[model samples]
Target: MNVDFWNEKFTQTPGLYGEEPNRFLKIQLQSLSPGYLLLPGEGEGRNALFAASKGWKVLALDQSPIAKKHTLEKARKNGLDIEYQVCDIEKFIHEGTKFDVIALIYFHLPSSIRAQIHARFEAMIKENGLLIIEGFGKNQLKFSSGGPKNTEMLYAIKEIKSDFPGITWEYEFEGNDILNEGIGHSGEADLVRLVGRKLSDYLIKISN
Candidate 1:
């Protein structure tokens, strides 16, 4: 994670990702019951703030202090209280804590450690928990929109399925879409979206 890069990003702009929540996230959350929602790399707090407003206990983590500060400021103005931590995602650990939902919207990471971080996040989900993700597809290189320039940082559907095995995929697709999240993510983009539910521990045991 580049703290300086994100620090400057959030500080330089009022809302780099905009104040509105991701469209996919908003739709999914609307139908599901509100519970503990965990958002990693929650830059600028748009999604986290939306979850908080919807009566979900939101817990967000980011590497940039400026991002956290901006998030808190937004929460305060919205009259919402959200738990936020400024730290590396790898170093964040909540012992014996589990969440009902984990959102990974646009949380692109270096390929070297993305798998490890994902596995750790998977372990934090309670039985039947939902994992929602939306990120730039491997084909995103063709577009001049937001996302990392490194192909390794982008996502592929096959890799997502392999990364979170033993879960039932409720929805999964990879295609192009017009994204207008903010000044950062605007225009047409190759996107990958997924929603998976963790199999119950008992079910896994019995199947094994």
Candidate 2:
């Protein structure tokens, strides 16, 4: 990913993306107790800052320095303290730390990289932890909303289930509608929404 491309994008006024938590994220986390939250591809920190406002200890990671700077500035403006890191998703290492909630919102990566990242995400979640994810589904290209033109970058239910079998589905579905994420994401879109909880020691074996 080109850091400059995103930097220049966020160089404009208020932010490239406005300061608001994702609607789906807010709803999913509403009933849960506050705890550590991981936000990958957390550009400009709008989501992270909002989560911090809700008492979540948020760790926002992005690849752009300008993104990090804007995130900190926005957090300070909101009187919130958020840990911001300038790091690419492919290079991130979680060590022994695990999160109660891991949110993946509109962060698209190549299929290979996504596979690796999904594995890491599974390892970084505490038992019974919730994983909330929203992304453009395969049908997104038919809509005018912002997203990659390539279908490979989009998500499918089967792909997610196969990749992270440890997560028991609480809710999973696809739909077409409006998405408000500022410049990069807006307008009529097709998306996949998932809210899942990590399974305990139980494991199911599938034969191909």
Candidate 3:
């Protein structure tokens, strides 16, 4: 992720992406109770702001300092408190903390460290805690809605299963959807959406 490019882009467009949360994330919120939530690569704070509004203690991370400033400004305006940090995946220090829910909506990570991040996520959630991920599928190159132009940054269902092992995936979909979240994402999109729950070691074995 190039911080300079993002900083420049965000500086140009204050509301580059609209303020509405992703519809998929909004749907998941209907069933989930607010708690400690972590959002990685949370650009523009669309999801972070909504989660905070719902009483979730939100910790949002991104590589762009401008994104943090924008997010914090919005949080303040809305009277919602959210922690937005400008850090890369390597520098994010979360050792003894565990969260109730961790959402990765449209956060496209490079393939190099994606597996490691997925493994780390399994250990960071409380038992039976939720993990929600939505990204452009590998086949997304055909669509221009919005996503990493690089295929390596796109997700595949088989790869996802391998990345997040020892968990119960309650919902898994690798297909298409129409995204109208904001100016950043719109039109028909090829997407991969997964919602999983962390399980005990014994339970994982039994379920498998």
lDDT of 1 by residue, 1-208 (tens): 4899889888888688888999999999999999999999898899999999999999999999898888899899989999999988778888756999999999998888888888888778899999999999999999978999999999988987788765789998899999998898899999999999998877766865
Clashing pairs in 2: none
Best by lDDT: 1
Runs of candidate 1 with Cα error greater than 4 angstroms are 205-208
Number of the predicted model whose TM-score against the real structure is largest:
1
lDDT of 1 at 133: 95
Which segments of model 2 are wrong by more than 4 Å?
Answer: 201-208
True-structure lDDT of candidate 1: 0.89
Cα misplacement distance, residue 158 of candidate 3 (Å)? 1.2
Model 3 TM-score, 2 decimals: 0.94
**Clashing residue pairs in candidate 3 (N, C-alpha, C atoms within 3 angstroms):** none
Superior by TM-score: candidate 1 or candidate 3 = 1
**Stronger candidate by lDDT (1 vs 2):** 1
Candidate 3: tens digits of C-alpha lDDT, residues 39-151: 99888899999989988898999999998899999899999999888897766778766999989888777888888887787778888888898999988899878888999
